[model samples]
Target: MSSRIREQLLSLLLEQGDAFTSGEEISRRLQCSRTAIWKQIEELRKEGYQVEARPKKGYRLVHRPDRVAPEELKPHLRSQRFGWSIQYHSQVLSTQLIAHDWARKGANEGSLVLTEEQTKGKGRMDRAWHSPPHSGIWMSLILRPTITLAQAPQLTLMAAVALTRALRRETGLDIRIKWPNDLLINGRKFCGILTETRGEQDQVQYVVLGMGINVNTLEDFLPDELMKVATSLAIEGGRTYHRVTLIASILQSLEEFYDAYLKQGFEPVRILWEEYAETIGREVRTETSQGTIAGMAVGLDPSGALLIRHQDHLQPVYSADID
Candidate 1:
């Protein structure tokens, strides 16, 4: 049950691959008893790993769990910092909330909080995001960038670009960004990004970039209300993908874009975002808290706000839904 022993056991299984490793060999290698090895194997099975035990041959790792465990991801992750330290949970109210706490406690800038399921996940305009277990990527990244509060919104656009590239490369699907922070495919939404910040008027302390991606969710698993407007990669691509691979790709892409944004400013990120935008040069209805404005989608302004050309003037919409 101890993390150290579990990790040691997992490392041994991974090293052996399909070959079986005897209990005595495992205990001697890990400096533990056969009873301790057995306990760890049971724990691995509880975590969804399929470990097979034979008469005298010993244990062989059959299949890894579908869930996104830190051990499963650490091997594939290449990011220097973004995914270096991960806080994983089987289920939580929201990864965003946990990330906020971690940021307040001085968690590293690139540390990530990821969960297999979210019971009360949040979205734009106080909407509820449905995050079923093992069906989607519900994660939040802690960022402590030295950017002004006005420039924080640009991070959302940067995330959209990162996710767009990652999804395109992974699924080979035509993934596009629906202005502000939604990722769409074939005019249906499959991902949403919410960037929350804590700071003074002139400076930002930290930003929590939360992302919800429906990766391997089946069509029938979706709620009836969401069937019209929402979809999953599995539904669109006709297959399920390895969540750990997608997560690794997303973190690598995000760190690349984040570093570029820090060194070169927002111009580079803005250009990349524009290339994948789905709302430009089309008619859109933007619903703000004040009211709804329907017009032609022009482009993004300097501050990353959506530029909508109304009847006779251009309006910059800071936050709204594109319909």
Candidate 2:
């Protein structure tokens, strides 16, 4: 079955929520025959959609599984490119590992690899990312943008702004960005971004932008030590959201910001980042390779470096574990 048909069928059933749509009506609306509609409905059943079918009444969507697979996400995606093609896994060591392979193999921009569980997921500074099965969004998006190597780090900050906008818009939670790549609410973390790029001397070849979001994870799923610093949207929002819907929103937001960045440069994205940033105008203690640097967090330089004011000197930090 064509993916487009699957998307259209699911969308139709969802739009008519709690109402049974007839087979004849569905066929007419989709411009397909009754046989085709029935076949597609069967496919949906296999994909975990609880569709009710009667003799005359066509189908009613009873339940939609919270899966970020193509069937679930593509139906909600309105972006022209992002999420147009997707790869899903039930379990993987890391989405980043597969994404890197696909990037080298010439995966198109916006090709996404997502999974229900990641056994060995990682965050910045080599810390382990706790990814529970079916409780969060763990994925890597492949992007082949027309940007230089020096500007690749900006992708991390750009993604921070994009996801912040998406989460705040979708869930209405008060989320803020933590410098280069994390999102927090009420001084606790719910999302992290890890951007990896392969490039020539001055130009980028491809970027595998990885995102790990804690969405529906309940408090019991968290480790005892993580309860203080880690949290999920479900916990903060006091309810669960459809992971597929959130994924679609994030993809749309990323694509929008990405297009703007390509045309308008980092100035616009930087402004948005500052608006959502929680690290600015605060004292920061960052651990760099050279040594620990304690300074007052001020702003970001044009290239997306965190500018710190230490006594009389302004320092730009490219990579660090900031507090």
- TM-score (all chains, Cα) for each model: 0.93, 0.91
Specify the highest-TM-score model's number. Answer: 1
Clashing pairs in 2: none
Q: Summarize candidate 2's per-residue lDDT along 1-323 as a digit string, tens digits.
A: 46667778888998999999998888889988888787887888887889989787768999887678776777688788998878889899999999999888889999999999999999986789999899999999999988999899999999999999999999999999997799999999999999999998899999999999999999999988999999999999999999888988999999999999999999999988989999999999998886788899889989899999976798899988788
As a whole number from 0 to 100, the lDDT of residue 79 in candidate 1 is 87
Off by over 4 Å in 2: 2-8, 24-43
Q: What C-alpha lDDT does candidate 1 achieve relative to the native structure?
A: 0.91
Task: Say which candidate scores most in lDDT.
Answer: 1
Local distance difference test values of all predictions, in order:
0.91, 0.90
lDDT tens readout by residue for model 1, 82-150: 988899999999999999999999998999999999999999877999999999999999999999999
